[model samples]
Target: MSNDVAILGVGMHKWGKWGKNFVEYGVKACLDALKDAGIEWTDVDFVSGADTVRNGYPGYVAGATFAQALGWTGARVASSYAACASGATGMNAARAQILAGMADVALVIGADTTPKGFLAPTSGDRPDDPDWLRFRLLGAANPTYFGLYARRRMELYGATEKDFAKVKVKNAAHGFKNSYARYNKKFTEEEVLNSPMVSDPLRLFEICATSDGAAAVVLTSMDFARKHTANPIKIAAISTVTPTYPNTVIEMPNFATDSSAVVGLPDAPFRDSIAKAAYEEAGLGPEDLDLAEVYDLSSALELDWYENIGLCKEGEAERLLNDGETTMGGRVPVNPSGGLACFGEAVPAQAISQVCELTWQLRGAAGERQVKGAKVGLTVNQGLFGHGSSVIVTK
Candidate 1:
């Protein structure tokens, strides 16, 4: 694939309950991205949207809805749905179009108004639906899966709840500077440890909150970017990969592991595979990354990402955390944008928001929270039900 896509601009609607419709949030973010790119909405040749589950039938055709809301410029429109990975997938589509010469400039948008309480499966008890089955049979809220992973890490690597708390502490400090973060308040280790338990070994503070937010990006061909700005941060790779079978790594909302009963799972877990694909495509390794923005739905998940992204060896993530290696001003920092631990889960908007943070860091515009002298950045996230996303950005 051509590494010729450049991010001209990125924007986000301030996260939190604004009591507005998803379309309004999306339009605001879209317009902000256009303004940031110094381009007009009419100048975009195509638009891609990350689909959100609507209260009614209106959610399915997100691209058309967003386009119409923006005055129907009749730009080539596409909508993508990949659960939490929807935003990254939307970005992947926009970049592909730019690389294929299908469109010189494209708009990528994702926004969501999430439901309260546990993120329930779609209504109706369809036995065939794994999401429903997991909920019904296992009573596994998302936190249960997070608990399983955290427990596994404890068993395999001896990572303590304190290590996980460090993640929350670090990210919360960073989030304190992020105006868009839903939870701007910092948490102490004692506070994190004392928070109400959502699942075994994971407390409410340890888990990311469901948030309402929107994010958008303006992508263009490298040629177009060069004409518009001298130093546009370019997207080196976008990995929208899936898992291999016998995926023994137990994922969310699944009652049983991929039957090692049939075939042995690959040595690398599916999560690592996502980052590997992006690293391979970018012709760079994790060592080359100046910073990373990963999905930290739970604090334990952040530790897992440190190893999965090859920033550290297996079970060594805690050591890295203790060494302050993953914090800002440390070697090859991870989640300098505060991650979902601080930002919370905006679902469709989260992955795009990761890139938005990377763009700011690469442009040397991230005040205070910036990773000093960052040249290459990576964003990694896994969507439930087998969707994976990883993107590499370089100055």
Candidate 2:
């Protein structure tokens, strides 16, 4: 019972403020993926769509919506919503169907159309909703949370503003030639520091923007892959675990962490557990990774991902960045596709975009940003609430 699923093809609609219906972007990506896989739309028997709650009715029934848009042939459909982790959830669903012998070929897709400015909670007046309360009561938008994390790094790890700027500089350079990236121009440390400070120590350029984009992947069982392609990248693991009780970290849109008075701390923190679970499922470790594409909502957050994904020890992420170990041609190049730094946050589409980058890197087709000879790559992302996402892919 090998839990492997082949990634036959991956595709994306260029990330930007396209100002079009999300379904349009989704369909384009799906068509691109189908073409890349060298298969007809009829070949797909399952459709797993990452949902967008902000987009009204079509977004709610994303799986069926996409099926209809693609000229439906009665494919079984499922929709998933896990905030930013939506794409990974959809991918996992498709993989499960393939592994369960329910479907030989499947399409996993995500697309988003976001508004300008900081992402806020849904339109509501509910007093119990922490998402709305955070904005209403504390005025704590996303950048506020990013600021808190950046300040924590400075105070705890002796990281400086320059250290955070370096992350932007590095990623900007990596994505300079990425055709799909929205903000591809490279920046210098001085330019990053000179930008307006939106959230305390974090400059405006250090934060990821909200944009419109789409990404899609075609997946099949290992047996089907062997007949379709000579050497296809296989999904070694997909971890969408939730947090354990007494989660101490006060994450996004939450005012308080779980009280530790009743229950003791778990064996691992929520973030650490994300990649650890994936590694366990894949029987691999950080040492096995050739590269990684992590959710870098902010420049400082990228440093946190290094430790969370076992790339380096806790508090050593600054040193890893300064040492150039996490950059291209380094020990483990993280975010060679430039990450959120260049592409911005397209919500549901982002996690799928990360996997698309991994597939290209594994095939050594990632043009200028390619991590040389990359064989095994990992993608890690987290979203609102306890949603955790991580995927391991091997060539």
Candidate 3:
């Protein structure tokens, strides 16, 4: 397919615990995007929404939900559900539709009203579903899985609690600069280290919270974009991949992992494979990237992504962080928009917001947090159940 689909506009509703309808958040963000694109609702040929499961039946019919909220211009509609990667999955749907000549322009949206604490399993009696069984039997929340990874890093990679604390400090600094961020207060290493521990190795400050937020983007074919604006940012590549067999990594809400002693592990791990696909499609590598926004579920997870996304050698992530490279103005800055640490896991809306940050940075409109001369940006996030996403955007 062509690599010239352009993002005409990006918008978001302020992320927080707003006790309002998800429709309100979604429509506001959509209208903001439409206004930014200088297009009317009637101009949109199609629309797509990232499905939310936390809400009631309306969550399931996300596309129709948003369309009805936005006054229904008889636009073709679609929806997708991919856990935390849901928004990116929806974005891929819109991009694919535009590339196929099915629509000249598309509006993509995602929003969620996060529950108080860890998200619980929605299944009633599905014993086979790992998510349901793990929580039911062990009461092991998502943070427990993050703790496991953090501990593993300490043992295997000589990472320290200080290393993890450093991440909270860095992300908070950037978050403080973003007006759309939910938690704008800056954090310190002492504060993060002294914070209560939710799990064995991970602390409260190092982990992200659940949030309510919404984001939307307007996309169009390269030809259509040319007539609208001269400096159109292109969606260069979108990678939505799944894991290979005998996946040895222990993911969230799962009892165990695949046995790899006999069958052996895949050539590339799940996270690595996700980013490799994007790089191959974009014909670029870490060296070419100006910045990246990754799924920083925990501070340690950000370090893991630094390696997974090829920012540095496998064992060099901690050094990368200690040397001040992952901060806002560093070489190949990561999470310049504060990431999940600032905005928390809004899930469906999170990935869409990542692209929004990239759009702003590329446009040189990210005041205070802008990475100077940013030309290419990448966003990497994964949902449970083998959903992986990596989208590359370029000016």
Candidate 4:
């Protein structure tokens, strides 16, 4: 199948605790996207949903649930569950249908009504469930994993707390201009440094908050897009990859590191592997991107993505950040929409939200947060429990 899918429309719900149901937010985003696409629900040929565990029993069957809420039009449906990468996985599935000629117009939706406080494990104390065991045994909350990565970067790349704080400062400044962001307030290095510690090496402001939001996108075949609109943003690649065996890295909510007990870990890091695949599929390199939106669950993680996505060499992320290269007007701007650091983490909705930002930027609709003259853009995120993500979009 041809690797060509046009992004016709994008929509999103503001990131915050709006005290609303996930399905309501999903419907709102869907309607907004359909309106933007100049199409109605009945015009959709397929629907793909990114599922959230907190959204009740119907969450698992997200596509059908959303379809029913939107008044079903007999559209083909699919639901994907990949933890944080759920939304990107849904895009991958929808793109497959479009490329295969199974569907010409597809709607992708992701929404989440997150629980307040630290995200807890699933109910019941089943030792078989790794999510439960990690919380029960180690009490190693998500921040703990972030701390591990932060510390590793400090040790390996000489990244300082100040360097990490700068990331928060830059993102917060950008968020202040983003109306949809959760914490649209600026912060200084001292403020970030003084914030309460959630885990060693990670302060409260350093970690992204759990947010409630929804995002949707309308995707169609390039041929269909050309007939509908003279200018359409295209998704050149969608990479839904998995980690290589012997993944020594201890990821979020995981009890133990992938055992190095067998053969050693793979030659390339798991995060970089995702980008490599996307680059191969799109036939483009990181140097080709005008801007990027990466998963910045923590200020430190953003730096990690800089290296993983090939924006800089290992140990050079902090230098990029320090030089103001990753900010809005700088070279190869990243997370121009303020990223998770400012918008907070919306779980299932985040990956889709990233694309929404990219769509606006590519369309020159992004106001204050625009990466000037952005043409080729990329969105990179990682899902827990073997789900990986990377999406490359070009004008």
- The candidate maximizing lDDT is 2
Local distance difference test scores for all models: 0.88, 0.94, 0.91, 0.90
User: What's the lDDT for candidate 2?
Assistant: 0.94
Give each model a TM-score: 0.98, 0.99, 0.98, 0.98
lDDT of 3 at 159: 97
Per-residue alpha-carbon lDDT of candidate 1 for residues 1-395, written as tens digits (9 for 90 to 100): 36759999999987886656888888999999999999999999999989888434445667788899998887999999998999989999998888878999999999888776678888886999988998888888899999989999999999898988889999999878898887788889999999988887998999988878999999999899899999889999999999888777788767777777657667677999999999999999998989999899999999999999999999899999999988888997888877887777778899999999999999999998988999999999998989999999998
- Clashing residue pairs in candidate 3, if any? none
Q: Pick by TM-score: which candidate is best?
A: 2
**Lowest-lDDT window of 10 residues in candidate 4?**
253-262
Better of 2 and 3 by TM-score: 2
Total colliding residue pairs, candidate 1: 0
Write the number of the candidate with greater lDDT, choosing between 3 and 4.
Answer: 3
**Which ranges of candidate 4 are over 4 A from the true structure?**
none
Candidate 2 vs candidate 3: the lDDT winner is 2
TM-score of 1: 0.98
| Cα lDDT tens digits for candidate 3, 1-395 | 37669999899999999978888999989999999888888899988989999998889879889999888789999999999989889999999999899999999999888788888888689888888888888888889889999999999999999999999899999889698999999988999999998987889999999999999999999999889999899999999999887878998766888899898989899999899999999999989999999999999999999999999988899999998888877898899999888998888899999999999999999999989999999999999888999999999
Stretches of candidate 3 exceeding 4 Å from the true structure: 123-125
Displacement of residue 31 (Cα, Å) in model 4 is 1.0
Which pairs clash inside model 2?
none
